[model samples]
Target: MRRSLIGGVLLAIALYLGAGTLLFAFQRSLLYFPQPRAIGGPDRLLMLPVTDQQIAVTVRPLASSKALIYFGGNAEDVSRSLPDFAEAFPDHALYLLHYRGFGDSTGRPTEAAILHDALKLFDKVSALHSEVAVVGRSLGSGVAIHLASQRRVARLVLVTPYNSILELAQRQFPIFPVRWMLQDKYESWRYVPAIAVPTLLIVAERDEVIPRWSSEKLFAQFRSGVARREVIVGAGHNDIGGRPEYLSLIRSGI
Candidate 1:
């Protein structure tokens, strides 16, 4: 019986090691990836040069007191939706950020890398535009929240955002030590309460990627007079931005 117990313990150790190795190997897959595109057409995607990296930003001018800066979800090529976004806010200057290692941007993607690049982009935009409103979708929401917490933004919009990535990782990988294993812990929940700008959170009732409750939890923490929450009915994570009602809500909120 002792020998059998020893054998079982060894087998369990082997299994644990193997599982950890596999998770580490495919960590990139856990991130969102999207193809990059330019504004207007494939030939016109402009590259904005930063101190450390060159980011692909789709720019369009709209007539408003504020400028619109959008950050896409994980693995999303923010430049892909530039044309529509440009059309949406034709009068305000629209700036879409390509995260590190995404769409013409340089360097490998990591939590710190993304945040650093985002700060650089913010500084660049802030230098030129006096009033800047930020929008973050899904993974980008974390970036937007962090920026708003630190900087003075005119408005903030989060689509399909969550309380924290750590919470989502825990739910998806209950058996694994996801919180410790994750290198990009975009902890928005800790920063959201500090944001003082007008914040609008758009939650999809039927979002498949991020559950509605997670968004509600984040929304609950916001007690500022400018904070508001809206739900898009029959919309999922990917399609929520395409709906007319969603666009209307965004326009009205801003």
Candidate 2:
């Protein structure tokens, strides 16, 4: 009986180590769900040369000094939001990025790579526009926060934001050491204190993916009076964008 118990303990340890190994091997596949662009044409597309890859930007060009640059969720195709944004902000030029692997962009998505691309996009947009505002949703919120911290953004908005992807991963896989394995530990809270621009955080009242506490924790990290939080009643994580007040709140922020 003692031998059987010892054997069981050994098996459990082996299984645990195997699971962690598998998780680390395919972690990026689990985090990013690359989606094809739904709306695109030569007139609406901007090919940004980044390193060896050409990143695609869905654009609505305007001869104006005000512009908006948007970063989207892991599984999102940002081009879909172009119509609504164009209608809402007629005076502003719009640029929506397709992350490294998403849409027509080449290369794989990583936290560092995405942040670098965002900075490059910002530099390009700011060169033409005197005032540039930034918006990020879900996974992209981390990108936006990081960019805002490092750049001169006139206004900022984050939807369904989280304190860190590491915290979320820890909650999901409590049995594993997510902190050690998660390569893209998007810790938005780390950059919040450096954000000097006026910021708005839009939360879904019933966010199924991101816990309310996570978003609230990020909000609390912002310097006092630098950020405002708004909750959309009866909204879920995915459907919050469909809420009537969604674009209006965004409009108010930028």
Best by lDDT: 2
User: What do the candidate models score in CA lDDT, each in turn?
Assistant: 0.81, 0.96
Instruction: Write the residue-wise lDDT of candidate 2 on 1-254 in tens digits.
Output: 99999999999999999999999999999999999999969999999999999999999999999999999999999999999999999999999999998899999999999999999999999999999999999999999999999999999999999999999999999999888889999999999999999999999999999999999999999998899999999999999999999999999999
RMSD of each: 2.2, 0.7
Every model's TM-score: 0.91, 0.99
- The segments of candidate 1 whose C-alpha lies over 4 angstroms from its true place after superposition are 1-5, 38-46, 61-65
Best prediction by TM-score: 2
Angstrom error of the Cα, residue 216, model 1: value is: 0.6
Cα-based RMSD of candidate 2: 0.7
The runs of at least 3 residues in candidate 2 whose Cα sits more than 4 Å from the true structure, single-residue gaps closed, are none
Q: 230, model 2: CA deviation in Å?
A: 0.7
Q: What tens-digit string does per-residue lDDT give for candidate 1 at 65-126?
A: 66888888886777666767666676678888877667777766777877777777788788
